[model samples]
Target: MQESATIIDIRHIQVGYGQKTVIGDVTLTAGPGELIGILGPNGSGKSTLLKSLCGLLPYSKGEVLLFGRPLLSMSERDRARQVAYMQQEVQVSFGITALDAVLTGRYPYLHWWQNESPADYAIARQYMSFAGVGDLAQRPLHELSGGERQRVMLAKALAQETPLLFLDEPTASLDLSYQEEIFRYCQQICREGKTVLIVVHDIRLAAKFCSRLILLSAGGILSDGPPSQVVTPEHLYQAFGLQSAVYENYISGQLDIHTYDRRSAGQPGKAIHVIGGGGTIGTIIRALRENAYPVSCGILRQGDMDTAVAMAFGTDNLVSQAFGPIGRELGEQNRQKIAQAHYTILGNLYFSQENLDNLKAAFTAGRLIIVEDSPINSRDGTAGEAALLYRQLTARPETTVMKLDELLLAVEKRSL
Candidate 1:
């Protein structure tokens, strides 16, 4: 009775308690195989929206259609047959066995006084095994640990076998590994063509697993799309009032989110120019910006990791074509930014003929700080030609050579 996938079409829905509207105006539709994560700050109506969809909370405005039928008109039995919901908290009786608790999901298909069927027990056991809690089926629900109880709840929801599932913070009680496992389970079920809408507070976790994301703010939808589009700095700021750096982690190949606060940061001062390349500019630029130094990045190739990190940090990029030799126009532009900077930092970079212009441009800085994170001999890609110029720059009176930490402290202490 509950083994078919479904679609939900909600139009201009307004949900609230009495006169206080929580979701003022919202419209969304979900189809089979979609694992959608609803994310927002607290009081943004994430849980309320899930409840409204599962018919636990009524919408006073507009309509919700489930499987092409109006949700309000569906009988309670029919609604339960189509959707399975796992809420945030559960209060079961003291002595109910885990298997018995999961059997409750099969009640919609039974008569008023009927006991659970053999088939129901089988289904309950199946999902309990799937949720890695089959061995605890004989244990009392109240006697189980929080994570065990959570897995039992998951088993119950899975036993429903409904086309659409809603999980509201189901992983709240689970540890990090189990937290990820729950989402992984949801993803697997959705791949089998079920629809799942999860309400999660962990934004990055949601981004890593959910096929799509909906960010709510001020009782309305702020952003809705794939993680790459919705988990952006601007959207996160609008939704949570957080100043965040959202970037693709080069190593993990996943989105990395770091939140920063400028409240205690220094006032923006004279601009610093960063000569960044070969993946060494990220830490340098990030440190400069965190201390409220106005920094610009230059001579970065179009597709370099440097460009990506710079864009994420909102640095002004002085551009050059990727894999192309520095041209006169772009070389002049690099010099101009270098000349205007109060101090310029030359990052530890691989030196080559194509990027020789960047080394030359570093000489234009009124004052210079060169990061010697690695030995210059190994970084020379121009057969010692670029290293010779680097040696000359290090010899200048205004040039200061320091390790990365020393440079960071100098900036933090405001010592030129």
Candidate 2:
């Protein structure tokens, strides 16, 4: 709360233990009211980057600026006053009460012979309540469970009352509910004007709560942006070697991630064209990509669910305006893509005047796959125009109508 516009300015800093460098050329800046999640695979230096900040580890090169001043110039107390750090694990000596542990946060404000004052006790108690550990204040830290001890440690950090907070893998070892609770608390703390940098493993939790995300890989920063940009499949694959899909959850308005095994089906097997829109065809598109069918989706309106699914897979896409009929040029492009693919899929999309051209383009493919789960008349929305076209499509000798499971099996067999 007592800093300039930027709370932390980390220049190109390199940190390591003895001979092996863990983080290199890492440069990032943090502002007030930001909950920034540091994420990456194991051995990606997430913890190393954090340790280098508060003088826990010496940076061989580059510099760190706290409140626009050199980090190296700050005294130990000055550094402690500026930032509160809760490390991944704490090894407390036996018989130390939790309240006494929380009081350690007040050392920077005390003289060598001074004891924790009444006001300090009040502050410690308040934070313990905030961390949901007020009842455990008098209990010995060694007697508490790991989750309880972690919460008490959080209370200690909060009790420090610093402008910036750094927590490394704070929730990684906790139960699912505690993990979410800690993140929610961090979000609230950011709203009240503290900058929090958290090293996290749960991408979904980070995407749900953090304002910004920084993904690190192999001693370097791989991606840094808002959650929407940093939580993409490409970023995940690059950072964690995982095949994944990231999309906005409709109910929670948070980013949702689903990881898939890429052992064999992830390889490019066949080329396919998808014509879909509305809320339909997202699962179909995912199924195609999961099974390693190179997919091109077209004429999906900008914000449509179908468009989001296609983009998440990094598929070739021909987009249309968010709210409009498909235009001549785009429609023609869709047909061209259909012609180029080994097969084209006509999803069980509800027909509407806006996207009737997508249905018309289905006829362009040499082999067409139709997914129909309901009666045609029930889904037709273009005044029976789509029904007439669909009937003709089903009548074609080259067209095959299959249920979702059957289609996946057929594609798997064809790939073999």
Candidate 3:
């Protein structure tokens, strides 16, 4: 394939089984070095679309072009030389060594009745090692574990060395480590000018690795673009009926999703103000939202992890700038939010000079719930000033200090 050449062109294709249409009027253009992820819920035509692209499943209408040539006009061997396909599962009825399975990838390059040459074996072994399955070369394909067999099949596909690769849930059976390994390998190979289209169920993994994403829904394309464009909360809800919090994960520095069940019936009741940061208030915010409470968070810094979670859940939040102490203006805003709320929750966050105003504002709550997982003195970094204020707040007649578990139970009981 040359630079800027279109590797695969799927135009207005319709695919189905018997009389039922599973994919309808989908058009996509993939160029060299693009790693596209096919993502959607089950029965969304992810697998059927993949098979149709490579000719394993017939399309009812429209055309598929490889290198601007009609796909249906290509011979089986000719197409195999340009495209490599890995199915969802591989079952070997007859016993075959793993080495033999991988060596079969080279058949497209051989003549009829011709045996594999030494160079073909070398290529197979090279790919087996690359897939981390070199040690299992002598083992029987049927005797290998699920993950091991997946690696062997991946090796087979890699040995084909085609410019266009189609994988259907290739990492479905692998562990966490191997799942990342397979995606990383695909990324590495795509940099060398390979175009890969893979069907993936793990949204986080796809967001982290794929160059672009295609989301399907009910036999049609829902969204298609880079991960940031395709994995939005609105798209997820429309495609999968999921209510999810979509945000950038701080640790991985990638987009991540946290899905929740459908919201409970009835209007949101009882405003609750959450004053916390340093990643302590995520669960509290989620719990309140799940129970149909109007939740708001305040006095969090712009780049705080907790703030990101709050924004993803559509919480009303008042945020200050990062690395700066809360100003008097924002502090007053927080106090007003606290006054309006029916109840307030103070998460078990460490006390720092930058957030001391948050501690001061907690005094305005009519009914205060303090989560104290550890001693206050241990987490106080503001000399003795924070601990002194904390003592005064806890002594108030409306304050209730309890562990996280007890506080959650109390909230649940109150909601009931």
lDDT of each: 0.89, 0.89, 0.91
Misplaced by over 4 Å in model 3 are: 264-269, 352-354, 378-383, 412-416
Highest lDDT against the true fold, candidate = 3
lDDT, candidate 2, 1-416, per-residue tens: 59579999999999998899998899999999999999999999988888889988899999999999999999999999999999997988899999999999999999999988999999999999999999998899999998999899999999999999999888866899999999989999999999999999988888888999999999999999999999888888898889998888666888879888656664576788888887677887777777777889988988787887788777899998887798999988998899899888888888888889998889888999898887899999888899999999999999989876787677666542
- Local accuracy of candidate 1 as per-residue lDDT tens digits, 1-416: 33324499989999999999999999999988999999999999999999998899999998999988999999999998889999999997988999988999998889899998889999999999999999999999999989888989999988888989999999999999999999999999999888999999999899999999999999999999999999998998888888788889888888988777655675776799999887998887777767777889998988788888888888888878888789999999999988888999999999888998899988888899999988889999899888899999999999999999998887777665
The number of clashing residue pairs in each candidate reads 0, 0, 0
TM-score of each: 0.95, 0.88, 0.93
Ranking of all candidate structures by their TM-score, best first: 1, 3, 2
What is candidate 2's CA lDDT for residue 315?
88
Candidate 1 residue runs with Cα over 4 Å from true position: 1-6, 412-416
lDDT of 3 at 381: 98
On TM-score, the leading prediction is 1
Clashing pairs in model 2? none
